[model samples]
Target chain A: MDCVLGIDGGGTKTVCIVMNAEKEILGRGETGASNYQSIGINAAFKSIELAIENAVIEALKTIKSLEVQVICLGLAGVNRPRDIEVIKKIVNDLQKSHRLPIMWELEQIIQPDNKSNNIIICHDALIALVGGICRDVGIVVAAGTGAIAYGRNHQGISKRVGGWGYILGDEGSAYQIAIAGMKAAIQAYDGRGELTSLVDVFTNHLQLETIEDLIEFVYRRGMGVKDIAAFATLVDSAAVDGDGVANEIIDDALGELVKATFTVIDAIFCPHIPNPSPQTIRNDDFEIVTTGSVWKGKSNIRERFIKVINQKYPYIKVILPRFEPAYGAGLLALKQYLQKSDSKAAH
Target chain B: MDCVLGIDGGGTKTVCIVMNAEKEILGRGETGASNYQSIGINAAFKSIELAIENAVIEALKTIKSLEVQVICLGLAGVNRPRDIEVIKKIVNDLQKSHRLPIMWELEQIIQPDNKSNNIIICHDALIALVGGICRDVGIVVAAGTGAIAYGRNHQGISKRVGGWGYILGDEGSAYQIAIAGMKAAIQAYDGRGELTSLVDVFTNHLQLETIEDLIEFVYRRGMGVKDIAAFATLVDSAAVDGDGVANEIIDDALGELVKATFTVIDAIFCPHIPNPSPQTIRNDDFEIVTTGSVWKGKSNIRERFIKVINQKYPYIKVILPRFEPAYGAGLLALKQYLQKSDSKAAH
Candidate 1:
């Protein structure tokens, strides 16, 4: 049996999986952020190496004489063309040290390609979308550090919207919502704006006396968007307590999310999402997939997102991805290895 | 000669003047905040009495006034009708104590009042505007603890904008701009947003290691807006030295100031600047009066304000009010006294 490795690198941690040609899970390992820009190339290389080595060693312990063939990775910060080369070099260097028949490849697996090519270099969001829909036609919104909405149709055409970073866009992303909440809380504390418990909660969370104290934790100290996003929970609590300001902020965030989803939906319908059936959407058949930490964590935001969509497009069915993005990557790697072996034999 | 009195009550300190009916300065005295809400009514009364007594004694020591015929007071926190009654009673009691023919009257003067009637209770901003223009027709913006703008035309009509206290409005006010700078500095420090040296300067000012330390001084400790506003100077210094984020904040604040002034400008031109003459604008026809500690303080904000205004309303001249709002209160008191005397004679 051939050992295949799949990796999912995130902002804080990386998850790795090792399996064989029989599709039996062998081993799993976890490491820290392997994103080049965040941990630096040196640290990223070390982390990725450690993660793969641990997973491979564990798999070998269980399945002796396993021949490794394919190594697939879906990294957090490797979205650009330049990142591909860097990742390739890292993998090649690791291969030199280990001396195994490991082929480095990106996990760009789109569900549409599942019918033929099977595997490709893609984002975890795409994986999550595929896991949710298990089909080619759908949309996925990944809300985490920042928010992005991506959509595809039966024809395999994909489009994106509202993925702007925290500074510009990101609309309904956790970070965006947290920033808004922080702004509101500060205004309330200073008597410059409306009042809310959000300030109290935020200040207490930061262990300060005033909402102004959070300015350090939020702006000066360089808190993560995820950390800021954590404040959304406080906002939700306040909204439940009947804080008009907090409620307004949540509503505003929901509005932004709806707008983002609508953008993808419009793309799926018009220039982006093609209409397979001219007669009816029921016959047209489409699905909306959700991805990232935001969807998996809080129910309030998730419910709000659904409520917004239901109010707008009641016909659309929203689906939660069945598997983690890393699993999607693993499936892609397995299929790819199988295709290669079959083609080689045919030739 | 009949002694006339002028009183200027403020958030921090109070000033009182005993002058002759001829409008000649006699003697002055100083005390503390006369706001009953901030300082209890008892303390306010004691401060007012002590201040007046000192001024009267000083005046008598020199001129030995035949009698204090009329006394005028421009007090702070006397905006409410009930507050006016409380102040009136205080003065009436003081007048009785003297056992002299002193006609006592109360004037509600805070700031941001247009030229209309005497003894108009206004925000301190209006007083500062009068400090600059000393005219009946002009506009004034106070940019100290909080920013507020007030303007009046020849017909006694006044307009105010961006005076929504320290939170919602007060756009380019010192406190607002200072908070902006502080937030930028903190954002840079945290890694959540752009980086700037504002954190360094702020920490240095507060004698702290990180921006987090300063947060308590501003929020938990309940520091005055002036203390927070003081940091704006540091932002300016940093910006001058080429801090990108600091520069961006300064520019953004300047933009807000421009928007605020335009509100006043728009109000002025609402009726077309009342072009009675065929000529464009007469030098004496229109003027902008500025007051308040923020505007008078030596900051780059003033120059930017002038630059922005000139860019839009070039033909209009900006001037300083000849009398402080407290002095205006004095004038108002004198006017009322004369009207009473005239009515008595007619009767």
Candidate 2:
């Protein structure tokens, strides 16, 4: 029985799934973080190996024998080309070591076939785009700890906007919203900005009495991006309770999201008049898929984003993902497997 | 024979000046940074002592046997009451040690007099206000690595707006401007924002090939507030050379500064109708003093700031400081000396 493995690796956790050739889910397993940048390559290797082992073990319970044909990993922190080479080497070393039972079993089962299997590695956003729309040609607007909009046309041309992290970009993300809320609260305390209920909300949430204490909490104590991003919910709740400052912040964030989405759509679909030599995709019919925690919440940012996008780009359809990113990775691996087999048969 | 010592201590350098009863500039000296928060309290004490000793030595060149009457220090990072007590104790210890010739000479000469001399420690804005306006009753709009608008009424009541550092506030400062410029460059590179000349400006300035290199430079390489703040001049130059994005950033910064200044002015000058019980300083006439490097540059931010303030608060007069903050500290010490002598004569 032919099977493929898909892995979604992030800074906090890793998920692995097994699927048959027909794309039916066989087993799923989760483990610790596999982001090599944060947890180091060795630990990331261990986490990925553990997740694959547990997933293979779970799959074996329902099947007599399984031959793993291909693997795809959608990982965070895979930005530069150097990162791909580094992660590929780590995965190759893991395959050669054959330390885990799943790897050894797969090696024995696939030895007679003499067919070279493949391992695909890509940025997490790629899997998100595929999983969100379950296709290759659409846009994915992800707003979590950071934000980015990735779009692909039918011609295989891809474009991205605003994945510059918390410092440089991430304009419509949870981190930006939380940071704006914190700044507003501090401005209110300094009597330089409009007063908001966020002052009390943040003070109680962070267990701080005065807004001045936030100085030490943020700068001195060193809060991480995700830790700060967690406060976006409080800002959303405050906005829901009719705080004008919080509402403005949410509105600004939605505006940024709409602008970013529009930029991605224009870059991928629209061709410039003066310099039209770049083989533009020129597809008007595509979906704008939304993902990440920001979309899951009750905040009207998504509604406003859809409203603006619909008004501006009527051909673009807004949607929520049908499957998780891990499944999307599996689908990508299956697509790659079919493509490779079809090319071999054609030759 | 009586002289007053005034010290202005900052993160980068410290300045001290000596003024006699007639307010003559007897001597001036400079030394290293004395901000205790960054460079330990002991080092701060040593810097302060060295500056004072150098000033006295220079004064001795013109006059003989100078009796130091009062000392006033306007130091950076002197925020809370605890900071005041800590700095005061350091000053007292330095006085007790009398390690320098100036301290010993002044101690021996003033020992016979039973009158208690004074040492006043205050935030740098207070001295900037005094030195800028040649008096205490006015507003000081300081834009440096950070921005703050501080105002003092005739009744000794003072209030400050902004100065929450680079992250939470400092909206109109060089750091904010540079960050905004960098963000615009990245946004343009990502095709999410307007194309601007800042992309080439930052790429060449930071010795980077692409704008994406800024991610590693800012996040991985640990670029600091001052280092990033240094790029503000480049943004200014880019704006002057007709960069639309840079011009927009400058305009936004000017708008923030105008709003902050207006807030400080309203809080200090305008009395609330419902809660009028607080002792209101009913002075309609006061100068708005401008200081810091932002005012020195040719950028229209300052001109726009002045224009906006003039249009809104027509009664408030805006002017540049007449002297440096160190000379203002000397004036403050001289004022304290005269007031003490007047009370002694009355008794």
Candidate 3:
């Protein structure tokens, strides 16, 4: 029986899954962060390797003769071409260093001898796109700690919008929303902006009495992006409780996200010329899959997002992911393996 | 002759001026940054002391026995009670360490020779207010690297709006405007925002082809608040060339500033309760003095700000500073010295 490996590496943690050719999940594993930018490349490599090993170990318990076929890694901080090359090299070196019993099995089942070729690497967002819609030709709006909109057409042509990070961009991100909420609270404290429940929420949440205490929290304590982003939940709760300022912040965030989604959708589907890519899929309908903490649960943001998109662009459909990013990566890897096998049979 | 000293200490440099009781400028001196938060307390003390010595040397060249009567320092980064105490101690320590021939003359001339009591400390904005209008009351709209509106009413009741710094607030500051322009340029580059000439302007200004190069400039080069604030000029130039996005950014900034100014004006002058302070100087008319680099020279931002304020708040008159912050500090010092002398004479 042939099994495939999928790994999703993010800034905070790494998750790995092992599955059969039929896409049945055999085993899963998780480890610390593998984002090379946050934790150095060596650390990222170690975390990814540990996650894969643990997943393989768990999968081997189920089947006696498990042949590993392909491996796909969907990782964060893989923006530039150099990042891809560096990560690919890390994986290649890991494969050479460790001759796992599963590697020997993989070597026997896969032909063309280059085991490294069996490994596929892509951005975490790409895998999320594939995982969300279970296809490559759609848009994925990922709004976690940060936010970005990415889309691809049938011809393999892709475009991205609004992933410039917290300082420069990330308009619809949790960080941005949380920052807006905090700013509103401070403004209210100073009597410069509208009064809101966020003042009490933030003061209590941060374990302080006054809204001005945030100044010390941010400046003196040196609160970082993730720490600040955590405040988005408080803002959401405040909005749910009918805080006008909180609602405005949510609406503003939704507006930015919708604007970004529109930009991506227009670029991919409604090009000035026919289709930009040669092998472009000429379909009028497209899915916009959203997968992030922000999209989870019953929130007005999600409802508003869907309503706005439906009203503005009727041809597009919004959805939650069919599977997680790791599963999507596994599907892509299986697809690649199948394509290679079919080409060999044709020859 | 008794000479009053006024010093303006900023993040970039320090300026000192010696003036007589009649407000005639005797001498001036300039030195490096004295903002304690940025350059440390010791360095701040050194810079301030050096500036005063230089000014005194210049003044002594004209007249002998130039006795120092009072000194006022308008400085940046001196927020909170602890900050005030720390800066006050720095000034007190400097006085103890240095005993110039000028100090001996001052000691001989002034009664009840407690020289430390002669020193007055205030935030840079306060000095700008006093300097702009040459009075203790009214409002000052300062839009330099950061932006803030501060007002003191006839009741001696004061209120402030904005100046929360780059991260939490500073809505209408040069830093904020520059950042908006940069974000717009990047968004335009990513096809996520409207096309603007800012893309080309930023490319040429930063000497890079793509907006992505800014990531390196900001993150790698460690561009700071003031560095980013400098880009406001580029944004202004782009706006002058009729970039719609740039114009919108400028207009948005002006709106925030005007809103903040209104908040300050309303809080100080339109109080429901009776005036709290004993030395209330009730008046119907008040001046709104504007200062800082953003207000200098020809810019639509200044014009729009003034026009909006005039239209909205007819009671508040907007005008440029009658004197620089240092000279304003001098005026304040002279006023305080005279008041103390009059009280003593009455006793």
Candidate 4:
């Protein structure tokens, strides 16, 4: 039976899903971090290989025989033609190493062949957009530890805003929010800003006795981005519990996210006019997929995000992901494979 | 002759000044970085030893013989009692290793011993404050690659604001300014923000064909904080050339610096009120010495900072550093050594 594999590779983990021609998920697999930037290319690929092998092993229990004719990978840091080329080399290496349950010759989907041309490689945001809306077109607002606003129009035009990472940008990201919270706490401690309960919140959450210990904890202890980002939950909880500073911080973060979303929308969807007023730029109804852990916070960030979006574009809809990103990748691969096969049959 | 040594150790390099009881510069030396946070303790101490050796070697040319009364070291990351303990062990190690050009036994300046108790270790900010206005009192608004606002009242009460590093705070720092400039360029490129010449500025400065190359340069290729902070000069130049976006970034940066200065002033110099209004908090005429490369920008950051600060506290006079930080450290050591000697003689 014809099968397809979809993979979503990230810094923390790699998730894979196996689907049949009928779009039924046959198997699922997960493995450790596959971010080539953080982990070396070999380790990252090893995780992908292990995930694929595990997923195929599970699929074998259900189907008598399976042929993975298509595979789509949505990975982080897969920007630029050079990045795609690097991924292609790794895929070629995987095929040459013969580290698969089923034999499949991989190639770009454009060069259709029965024995080849069955792979699609793209960035993580694309899969999130596709998975969230269950389609290839629309915007995806991803605000986990890092934040990015990305979208693809019907004409296949794509645009992105704010994904500059924790240092330069990531304005609405959990990392930024957490940093703002910590800054507010420090400021309050220093008598530099408005008094806030975040001083207590950070102290208790981190099991610290005084806010001054934060310098030792934050710098001396060598806290990673993820570790810092984890504090966003505290900020959210504080905001929900009515801490004025935390609420303002969240408000500012959401505003930045909305701005990034609006920028993406204007780029790919709005009319191409230099400095066109929002009233001058007309847009059709569109569903924007909101993904990542930030949405799940108790601060009503999603509700606030939707409210603000509606204020700007009442026709636009904000939603949670309808499917996993791996599933979306699988769907994309399956559609491409079926479309090419049908076209060949017609010819 | 009773001489004193003042060493300023930082991330980039270490500077040492040898001074006499007459407050005359006997010798000067410069060496590699001694920031133990960046380089290891051994290497940092080695740098300090080399700078001190060189300075003392030059001082020998000026004097027949020298009795070193005291030495004060101002280094980065010398915070907390624990950090001081760690530095003390290293000082012991440096002394035990017998690495000095002259056999000078060291101890804390408080011990008041001839053969020992001659070293005083403090944070880099204190040296900058003393060095800038050539005093133990008054505030120092430092806006280098990183920034911090630190002040000591006449009564020796000290307070600080900002200096939270690149990720947390560093509001008015060159790193922050460069980051803001880059963010603006990216926003302008994405059509999310107003169009600015910063896009061209970054591209030209970085020798890239397009602004998108920044993504490749920033993320793909590793760029350090100092390298990014170097772009602050470009932002300053742009602001000087009348770029509205760059001007706004500079204005915001200066405003944050002013706020930090006010915060420090309020904490140390102003009356201890829970929330004293500006009118209620009258401060004595104290010069806030402005140090760091950011002040040298063509954008008139220093001028703008002065203007904003005067608007709030007219008595808060802003001035450039009157002396180098190492000289200030020497001055501090000289004063402490003289005060202790005079007290012992009186007894």
Candidate 5:
């Protein structure tokens, strides 16, 4: 029985899954953060190996001879050429030792940029698509510690709507929400803005007496990005209470997210390619697949994203993915393997 | 012979001058910071006494038995009514010992608010006028750690134009300038803003590769406000070399000062305060007395303030203050005594 291994590595944790030839997830495991640049290469690679081992061990309990397989990993920091080469060598050595015909697929391989690894022009959003709705066409508005929106058309055309980092962009992202919350706190402290209990909560969290002191800490001190991101929950709580500043910040973020979604749709579904021009293919409408931590449950963000998207493109349908991103990677690998076999048969 | 004592007590040092009723400065002495809030009551009083003793000794050498009568002091941090009352008693006791009347003027009394201490009432700017032209109805733009512009019209009806403090106001203030400079350095480090040599100067001064560490020191470690204020000189030097960020901040401050001057003139001069306004009573075209360390020289700020004022109100003349703010305190106190005596004579 043919099998494929897929791994999704993130900043905080890594998720690995073993799958059969039919794209059925047989086993899974999780490990620590794999951001090599941040946490060092040795630690990151070791964690990846451990997660794969655990997943393989788990799969062995259900299926016999699980060692025979193809491996694929959707890693967070495999964008650079050096990182890709290092990960490739490690995966090749592991496959050789296991005595399996395993193929390592860097996330960038599917991402269009790596011409050598371009088996399919796919993205994390595409994996998100598989996770959100288990469908080809849908939209996934992901809002966790950060925020980004991804959508895939029925034609298997995937597009990234948002997900700009903490600073310049990332509308409706957790980081943006936290920044908004902090700004509100500052305004209230300075009397230039309204007062809120959110400020108190934030101050308490930071162990500061005044909002001014908190600002000084955040601005001057090199506070962690994640720590800053975590403040979004405080903002969300404050917004629920009727703090105008908190509400305004959330609303602003929502507006930006809506704008970002529309921008993505325009880029993919609009008549123009680069921009409005004479030679362009304008489609009537397209479905969008949505998935992620933010859209998983009952949050204001989910409803807002839906409402905003519907307001602009009422005809468009946003579907939720059925599987996780790791499983999606395995499925893509299976599809690629099948397509390659079929092409060989045709020859 | 009637004599007057003028004292300018600051944070670092105190200056005292003994003058005859004829407006002749007979003797001057310097001591420590007599701002009671900065130095304890005992130290502040002792400094004041020492300053006075030294000045008196000098005066005695020239004019023996110079019956020193009235004493006026311009003090820092003597703002509270209770504090003023306490300080008033202390000064009165000192005066009584010398058989003289004591007058106290708290600089903060002229401030608009706690945050707006840099902004002074029109009357307070008169001190800059006193030091500059030794006359009423002149303008004084003082820029030291902060910036304030004060001017008055004849008829003893003085008006203050600018002096808003370091944060919200205080255009052309050293603290503001320095902060602007520091921000530029930070932006350069972060790569979000334009590159400037201020980064090197600031980093070298603080002995750090980046401001990240220093920022924590300033905010988290409770660095001194004066030290923060010192960054302005660094900003000035950088801006002089055409550092984009520094230049922008400096230029912005200069613009603000110019606008503040116009605001004072508009409200205190022609339109609002009746046809024959304070400026008209001053007998000349509106005279703006520039005072303070920032406005003392032919710096860009001085030229800018004058240029902006002249561009709008062609008839308005710019005047530099002859004396410091402490001297203005003496001017106010002496004026009060002169008024009382004149009233007595009239009766």
Candidate 6:
């Protein structure tokens, strides 16, 4: 069976899946973070290699032999040409040392930097777009620990807003939500802001004896941006329980996400129409997929987003992902391979 | 010579000043940070002890025998009762171990739990207020790496706003300004925000070859909040050079500071006047002092702050610090000592 390897790697973990050309997922494996920028090139390569080997081993249990065609790695923090080149070199080294039967054309392996479409290296945004919409082009609002609005037009032109991390951006992210919640609690405690349930919510949830202990709890080494982002759920729950401040926070988060999404849409999807109003730019052809933990909140955040987005861009629809990004990578590889084969057949 | 010891301890450094009852400065000393929450209690104690020892040693060169009547310590993160108790215990141990000629009256030394007015332990806000106003009562806006608006009435009731640190608050702080500059530059680079000089300014000033390199520059180990706050000077410079975005950011920051200041004033100073409009609060009796490096910017931030604040509270005068915080601590101790002597004579 001819299959391709699709790997999705980020700051925390890596997942690689084996899929046949027909888009059926055969086997999957997981490993620690494979971001070269964070874990170093060698460690990242080892993680990718380990995941690939385990995935291949898992697939072998059913298939007698498998011919691996291509590998697509959609990774985070890979935005520039230099980053792509570095990841390509790592892939070149991986094929040389690994036991997988990678059927790279002879000349391509000899000269790794040459133009070979077999290996695809790109940013996580591409995988997110393809995976979220289950197609090549659309928009995605990712509101996890960090937030970003990304969109790719059919012409392959992509635009992104936000994603500047906790300090600079993450406007609609869980991190921002959590920060706003904490700030409101602190301000209310100082007798400067309106009273909110977040004060008691954070205090009770964090198991803090007093609200002042929150300072020590946050500045301590163990609690990082992700851990802080986790507290955003409590704010969402408070909003669900009819807390005024928490509801306002959720509304603000939605407003920011919607604004960012509109920016992306205007840049890529509606460039021909000058000064397209939010109500007029009704893009029906592409779906707006909402990803990350913020959408999974107990509050009607997702429903509210859909209602507001649809009311503004009446033709557009908001959705959840049909498949994971690793599977999307496999589908993308098969797509490119088939496209190339069709062009060759026409010739 | 009848003198008192006053120490101002913070996250970066500690300062100790020795002054006589007549408010004559005799000697001064400096040491590293003495925040026990950040650096352990032992290290904080040693720093304080070293600063006090150096000051007393320097003062002994002029006076035959220095009798330290009282001691006042205004330290950061010393807010709760537990924190004050811990600092008081540290002070007690220091007097027992060192040679400061502390006149504890035989009771405070044997049973340290007793209420002896000789040692004063307080939050940094009190020292800032006393030092900034050169008296015991007023509001002081401290906008350094962190921002806080604090005010105390003559009746001794104090109120604070902000000062929640980089993650939670720091509304008008240098850190927030720097983060805003970084965000604007990144947004402009992504074509999602207005083009501004901040992009080129941050890129060239930071020595970054590409804007994307800023991610590594920021998230990499060595760049903490203070280092990030240092970049705020560039934004101020850009505003000075007529960058619209930078100017707007400055205006927004000033607005937040003014808002926090009003909150502090309303809490402590304006309790009798409910719903007093910002324009109607013409407080001529007390000064509103502004401190920290943000006031040192060439962008006329301090001047603009004064203009806006004075416009709102017509009769309220804003002024710079009349003395350093450590010196202010000495003045506070001397004032208390003289007041105590007057009360004893009345008795």
Single out the weakest 10-residue window by summed lDDT for candidate 6 chain A.
A103-112
Q: How does chain B score by TM in each prediction?
A: 0.81, 0.90, 0.90, 0.92, 0.81, 0.92
Q: Write the per-residue lDDT of candidate 1 for residues A1-347, one digit (tens) a residue.
A: 56667777777887777767765668777889887766788888888778777777677675666555666677753555566778777765776765442443433323454422332456655655654675546787887767777777777777666554553356677776676677677545443457778877777777885554453455345666677777667776777788888778767766766776776665556543444333345555687777756565333767878877866567778878866665656665776788777877998
Model 6 spans > 4 angstroms off: A36-46, A80-93, A96-117, A275-284, A336-347, B39-43, B67-69, B80-117, B275-284, B335-347
- Candidate achieving higher TM-score, 2 or 5: 2
Instruction: Tell me the RMSD of model 2 versus the true structure.
Output: 5.6
Better TM-score candidate (2, 3):
3
Model 4 interface RMSD, one decimal: 1.5
- Superposed model 4: Cα runs more than 4 Å off: A107-117, A270-285, A311-315, B105-117, B272-285, B311-316
TM-score of 2: 0.83
Local accuracy of candidate 6 as per-residue lDDT tens digits, B1-347: 77888999999999999888778878888999999987899999999988988888888888876777778999987877878888989887886864664443323322245577778888787898898799888899999999999988878888888887888788889999999999989888877689999999988988988776788788754598999999889889999999999988888888888889888878877788887665445542688899999889898888988898777676788999989899878878888778777877998
Worst window of 10 by summed lDDT in candidate 4 chain A: A105-114
Considering DockQ, which of the candidate structures 3 and 6 is the better prediction for this target?
A: 3
Q: What is the TM-score of chain B in candidate 4?
A: 0.92
Q: How much does candidate 5 score in TM-score? A: 0.51
- Expressed as tens digits, the lDDT of each residue in B1-347 for candidate 2 is 78888899998899999999888888988999998877898899888888887888888887877777788899876867778888878776766756544533223323246533577788899999999999988999998888888888877888888777877888889888889999999988987778999999999988997898888788767788888888899899998888889999988888888888777766767646433221332345788898877665566777777788776656567898998899989999899889878977998
Interface RMSD of each: 11.0, 1.4, 1.2, 1.5, 10.0, 1.7
Query: Each candidate's TM vs. the true structure?
Result: 0.51, 0.83, 0.84, 0.93, 0.51, 0.89
- In candidate 5, residue A277 scores what lDDT? 31
Candidate 1 has a TM-score of 0.51
Per DockQ, the best of the predicted structures is 4
The DockQ-derived docking category for candidate 6 is medium
* Top model number, TM-score: 4
What DockQ, on C-alphas, does every prediction get?
A: 0.03, 0.57, 0.58, 0.65, 0.04, 0.54
